[model samples]
Target: MITYSTVKSTLIEKGTRILKVLQFGAKTADECAPFGDDSNPIANMTAIYAETSTVDEQVIIGYINTKQLAAPGEKRLYSLKNDKSISFYVWLRNNGILELGGDDHNLVRFEPLNQGIAAANGEINTELQKIQTAIIGLGGAYTAGHISTDIDAAKINEIKCL
Candidate 1:
């Protein structure tokens, strides 16, 4: 009994807006450096890149951890965890990919080491059928008999009332 919207805009969620308001920080309680200190915030060379963020995620151009000398290349120096139980997104570690929020709480990033980029998004490609619907609305992919060179006398006549 689930209902879905047919409108193009409604089908697509406004991820960019969420990405804009999203705050990046360490998973630690203090929300600071890997060593649990608020002195150093920007440890990894992580930064936003390529148009601020993609429609699906926020594109950053820096490693997760490659700044701190303690645990070089250990993990993302900084990350956002849904400790507040916010059902917006989740932090993915083993895969180095944070995906849309779900019913799972395993790990969060609270270190400072490397340099990389992060792509944050909510429900990527949630509706695959939407693409097909768009294609159909556009008059389908192609047809052989109905479509022909306008230079053809019969084809031209078919298009006109003549």
Candidate 2:
């Protein structure tokens, strides 16, 4: 098996650059000696020794378990972050649960539903209000105002740094 190491901080493109191997001993030159001299290896390793495979001050660690599960049940998970900041963090459970955001207060759990997440808008909220009103009109002892207001576009917007 060929082990890949990064001698310095590297940048990985989203759609390009194939990174199928695990990188170990990042920023540690001694670990790269066994891999032999590299004319030009992954992450531009031209030096005789190895360096860290940090992408934008974030280290990418990958794990592979071939014998853990069947081919169809295989799963891959990744978490990228640094001491100062977090690049990306997510978890996928074996029961098909996806959790995002690292902390409990900020974390958002997405449970499986018949129809995935719906877009935030006024129409759905309006319909929901009507249903609540109808339920109350039928002498149902249920509290109302769960979805009091509709979410408008101005209240939320997509923001991407890069």
Candidate 3:
């Protein structure tokens, strides 16, 4: 039988990294900007909107990329992705959005593709759970702690008696 602790530990260790990436916007060219060897075109327009609470004080900014030379009245607007959800605790700690003793809240918008990414992430997590169950089964009850140490010892004594 599967125990809550076993699943909880497995989920916490294996799921955290996957969840972090799925929840936060992946570090990609689109998010980081300056696709190739080109310099940042929006450097002049970049403005720091907020600073994180972490020791490093990572800042979030608003900027306009105008290297492509858009037509008059046509300008590019950058926004966060919809599927990635930043944690309230992390946001508070990293973004400094809330004061040290203040209540945390959602200060950023979700990406447009958030639904699709979230669904995929859910499927992956479910698959991991199934895999863990199969592994424990193959390794036997002792491998998965389905039987208590006392019961295992008792079983060993019965086998020794035989």
Question: Candidate 1 vs candidate 2: which has greater TM-score?
Answer: 2
Q: What are the clash counts of all predictions, listed in order?
A: 14, 4, 8
Candidate 1 lDDT score relative to the true structure: 0.28
- Assess each prediction's global lDDT (C-alpha) against the native: 0.28, 0.38, 0.30
TM-score of each: 0.15, 0.28, 0.20
Candidate number achieving the greatest lDDT relative to the actual structure:
2
Candidate 2 structure quality by residue, lDDT tens digits, 101-155: 4435542233321123343434566777788789889988655444333224323
For model 1, residues 107-144, the per-residue Cα lDDT tens digits are 32222111111111112232334555676789886322
RMSD after CA superposition, every candidate: 26.2, 13.2, 26.6
lDDT of 2 at 36: 43
Could you give candidate 3's per-residue lDDT for residues 68-87 as a string of tens digits? 42345443322222232221
Which of the predicted structures, 2 or 3, would earn the higher lDDT when compared with the native?
2
